[model samples]
Target: MTFDLRPWQLADFPAYQALITAPAIATAIGIDAKSTVSQQQAFENDLYQTYQAAILIDGVPQGSIVAYQRANELGEPLVNEADIAYFLSPAFWGHGIMTDVITAFIAQLPPHFTLWADVLADNIGSLRVLEKVGFTNHGTYIDLFGRQIIQFHLYR
Candidate 1:
């Protein structure tokens, strides 16, 4: 099973749209404003403008991880470092799916030394994922969309 990270494409809209609407997953990931097809189209189009990856299982798109960010407010300056937000279908959860996907991206991508992620403070599952993958807590955002979040990072 070769798990590779593919570039995001407009054709990924339907699968992504479906993932975004799954309530259990969406709520846990973050606020999901029910998006229209046009909105979804615009999103798929927009992501092409960034450094993103489609988590492909043997070349079939399973999920996506988006990398975007500014310099961290709570940490030292590290160029090419970024904050990321991403998701996969609940069906794809716990299959060592994201673990493999993230590790590969971090290795091949240009930001060789710095990476960070933030999750709601109450989101234990997400916190675990980040920690298991080597990110540590920086601090917390009192309310990101009305829920407090703990920031995590991997830096050298």
Candidate 2:
């Protein structure tokens, strides 16, 4: 099955929440499995300033892809960099949906942009997806969850 990425809609919130909270999906995507739609929205409001899109399969909101400044805090130095985050329903894992969705998203980015992403060091699938789309590993660091994080970057 094929899918497309489109600007996110308010109506996609519920499906987005559902997708992110699925047990295996949440674990792989490195998000709290208990987050509600409201919490998700707050996150989007805070983190999706640069870009946000819903992953649609046959018109259904199956997941989301988003990018924004890695540090949105007030004191952080402004930078021409964005970090991407995405999650899909377990039902669609290994289908190369994200590989396709993100490639298209990156191509449409503004010039001089540097895209970044962080995946759990153990999530081979996500790491492979990032590498497949030309992202190079910058390094690894430990996250708050105590899981090792592999940072990936793409320069345009």
Instruction: Quantify all predictions' global Cα lDDT against the true fold.
Output: 0.70, 0.80
Expressed as tens digits, the lDDT of each residue in 1-156 for candidate 2 is 799888876666667667767787677665666656544864466344657778889999887788876556765844768888887777888888889999888887888888999998888999999999999999999987788999999998
Q: Least lDDT summed over 10 consecutive residues: which range in candidate 2?
A: 41-50
Give the lDDT of residue 92 in candidate 1: 72
Highest lDDT among the candidates is held by which one?
Answer: 2
Candidate 2, pairs of clashing residues: none
Return the lDDT, model 1, position 129: 77
lDDT of 1 at 146: 80
Candidate 2 local accuracy as lDDT? 0.80
Q: After superposing candidate 2, which stretches have Cα over 4 Å from the reference?
A: 35-38, 41-43, 46-48, 72-77
Candidate 1 structure quality by residue, lDDT tens digits, 25-45: 567565354757644754564
